[model samples]
Structure formats: structure tokens, C-alpha cells
Target: MAANVEDFKKRLDEQDLHIRESWVAAMKARIVRGELIKCQRGEGVNHYKHCRDLAEMYTGMIRENKVKGYKIIDTE
Candidate 1:
């Protein structure tokens, strides 16, 4: 048995997540983080930590540039 194929498909459809859209969202997030690092700063004790974290996130996205999910009906 495929274990309730209808239920599985219903759940999957409910999610309605698209891989390309997810990747684009991630890219936009990275761009915002980069903009913060380059164009904003704060006067506080944790300012350095905040900036470092942003930089790390921006670079980390470079290594992780893929969206993972189901690929039904492969056209390739």
C-alpha cells in the first residue's frame, strides 16, 4: 500500500510550497541581511555580534542555495 495516497496528497497540496518560490524568498532574505550589514549599525554592546551574525548568514546562504522538497512529475 502507498499508505493513504489520498491523505498524503491532500497534505502535500495543503502545503502549496513551490521550490522556485522558496529559493527566491531565501535569496531576498539574504539580500536584506546584506543590506543591513552594509547600511545600518547600532550603538550598543551587542552591535558587533549582530553585524557578525548578519554577515555569517549572508555568506552561509552562498553555501546553501537550494530548496529541498518533493519533485513530482519530473520533466528532466
Candidate 2:
């Protein structure tokens, strides 16, 4: 019984770590996305030129799976 309880506690701790890691990744992604948006917020046609670096950073982050469920739409 004691071993079972320890196992359950260990599993719960692992789950907590997983949840924290996911949350941290999401928060970091949100900041990165916000920076990219801010860079392009009102640039219009010039956004491509002005925001290229941020866009590249965002794309790299996504490609590296630093965020979930996002992908680069185009490189043109």
C-alpha cells in the first residue's frame, strides 16, 4: 500500500512538471508572437522588410516546436 501511494505521488509530480513545461512554452511563445505582431502592427506593405527578422525568429521558434499548433504559411 505504501509503495502504491509513493508511485501515485511520483506520477502526480511528473504530471505537474509536464504541465508547467507546457505552460512555460506557451507563455514564451505568446511573448515571441506579440513581439512579431508589434513589429508589423502598422507597417502594411513595408512589413515584410521591416519585420523580417522578427518573422524569421517566430518561424524558427515554431519550426523548433517551441510552440504548439502553428506553422509558417509562406516564405515568399
Candidate 3:
């Protein structure tokens, strides 16, 4: 029963991760398509300074959905 519950929880987490990943992809697409400006109008390395908001949001999402490393076992 505990294994079943763990599997169910893992499934739910995977679904949430998928939804978050989709959102991130859409945001990236908009930025790439120029529909959403990700940085200020400038021509220097400092241009990234204007993108702190977007960067922070992206980082937050990634950090929130981060998964721990797990080893895969091969049973032949």
C-alpha cells in the first residue's frame, strides 16, 4: 500500500512538473518570437540586469520543481 501511495504521489508531482515546464516553454517562445521583451533596450552585458524579474521567476520555478538524483536499476 505504501508503494502504491508513493507511486501515486510521484505521478502527481510529474503532472505538476509538466504543467510548469509547459508554462516555462511558452514564456521562452514568446520571448524568442519578440512578443515579450525579456530585457531592456541596451547593447551591453548589463542588458541582463533588466531581466532580473524574468530570471528570478524562471529560477524559482526550476528550483521549486527540482528533483533529487535517483539511480536506475537494471533487472534482467
- Write the residue-wise lDDT of candidate 3 on 18-69 in tens digits: 7777677666645543421435444247656766666666566555544433
- For model 2, residues 1-76, the per-residue Cα lDDT tens digits are 9999999899888777766776787677678889889878878779999999889877876666453322247778
Give the number of colliding residue pairs in candidate 3.
Answer: 0
Q: Residue-wise lDDT of candidate 1 within 1-76, one digit each (tens)?
A: 5779988887777556566666786877678676765644563566666576666666677667656565567789
Estimate the TM-score for candidate 2: 0.68
Task: Provide backbone clash counts, one per model.
Answer: 0, 0, 0
- The lDDT values for all models are 0.67, 0.76, 0.60
TM-score, per-candidate, Cα-based? 0.36, 0.68, 0.42
Question: Best lDDT goes to which candidate?
Answer: 2
Q: How high a TM-score does candidate 1 get?
A: 0.36
Which model is ahead, 1 or 3, in terms of TM-score? 3
Put the candidates in lDDT order, highest first. Answer: 2, 1, 3
Q: How does model 3 score by TM-score?
A: 0.42
Better candidate number, 2 or 3, judged by TM-score: 2
Instruction: List ranges where model 2 is wrong by over 4 Å.
Output: 42-44, 62-76
